[model samples]
Target: MADPTLPRADEAPGTIAAQVNKGQQFTSFDVNAFEIPNQREEVWRFTPFRRLRGLHDGTAVRTADPSIVVDGVTDGVTVETVGRDDQRLAEGGAPFDRVAAQAFSSFTDATVITVAKETELAEPVFVKVDGPGAGEVGFGHIQIRLEAFARAVIVLDQQGSGTYAENVQFVVGDHAHLTVVNVHDWADDAVHVAAHHIGVGRDAIVRHFAVSLGG
Candidate 1:
């Protein structure tokens, strides 16, 4: 099924015609450039503002140090943690919302995973992000790239307690085949919000599956 948050191409002509600013896109993040969501905008209308724990606004602080583990490494795959200022960070899509902007501004480091061209992995790459319990709030960013003709599968597992917001980006090169699975299993009191952006190159094949078992 298509994600409800994304616009569908199969909508009726009238529905498409009813859209305002047909060619306009959301504003890119600039920290001071975006306004905090007030639950009135289209993006926030369906979100529970109170449950965000100030993630939508500037009141949230990064009080917890989340643990990240990468397992099942295979040949031709590379994983590294880098400062947010890394040039590769800009290769992904820009932030289109305040929360995304906030996450970018708040996070000091980012994780990057790269699959070399023409390389096919026999085992799935597993990335686990575990948050510390309590009322802490945290922010994070992750980027995954598959070079041309690369074939791989990745699984992201998120768990534990906290108010966390994150932005993830996937870049698929020409003729590359990439599969991603995201599993969210959080503590009952945990509050998490995330945005995922994907850029598919010509003739590339990309598949994404998401499962939310808890929150």
Candidate 2:
């Protein structure tokens, strides 16, 4: 996909910002760039504000990092724990809302998984995220990238008890195939919110399934 931050050919420089598909005007990594919703906004109207645990207003903060365990790695796969200053952090996209931006701003580290160009994995990759504890707050970010012509299946299983907000991204290169299955199975008292961004290159194919069986 073309970088949304770059000016169009017909426009002058410094004239671009990322935009959401339906309602958002612009995307930013800054949490304050977005306003706090009061249940009047379309997006937040259906959301449960009382269970947010301060993710919208920033009162709830990350107390401990989530324990991330990656399994089923193949030869062409690369997994890394990177700092916030990593050069590849936000180039693909930015947060569109306050909770997502707060997750972007508050996370102590990021999990990045990349598949090499033209490599196809026969086995699926499993990523399990264990939250801190009940009543605690956690912020997280994760990015999965598939280079040109690569094919892979990824399963994200989120577990534990807590209030968690996260921003997850997927970048698929041209002609690649990516299938993602996200399971949101948390404790009964846990509250979880997440924003996902999928950027597909020319001719890329992506299949995403989100199942909320718990929480």
Top TM-score: which candidate number?
2
Give the per-residue lDDT of model 1 (tens digit) for 1-215: 54433434643211221224645455355655567788677756888888788887888888866678889877898999999778877667777778887887788678999999999999899989887566788888889999999999999999999888888989999999999999999989888888898989989999999999998
Which residue runs does candidate 1 get wrong by more than 4 Å? 1-20
List, residue by residue over 32-59, the lDDT tens digit for candidate 2.
Answer: 6678977899767888887788988989
Off by over 4 Å in 2: 1-24
lDDT (C-alpha) at residue 5 in model 2: 59
Minimum summed lDDT over a 10-residue window in model 1 is located at 11-20
Cα shift from native, residue 185, model 2 (Å)? 0.9
Q: CA lDDT of 32 in candidate 1?
A: 53
lDDT of 2: 0.86
| lDDT for 199 (candidate 2) | 90
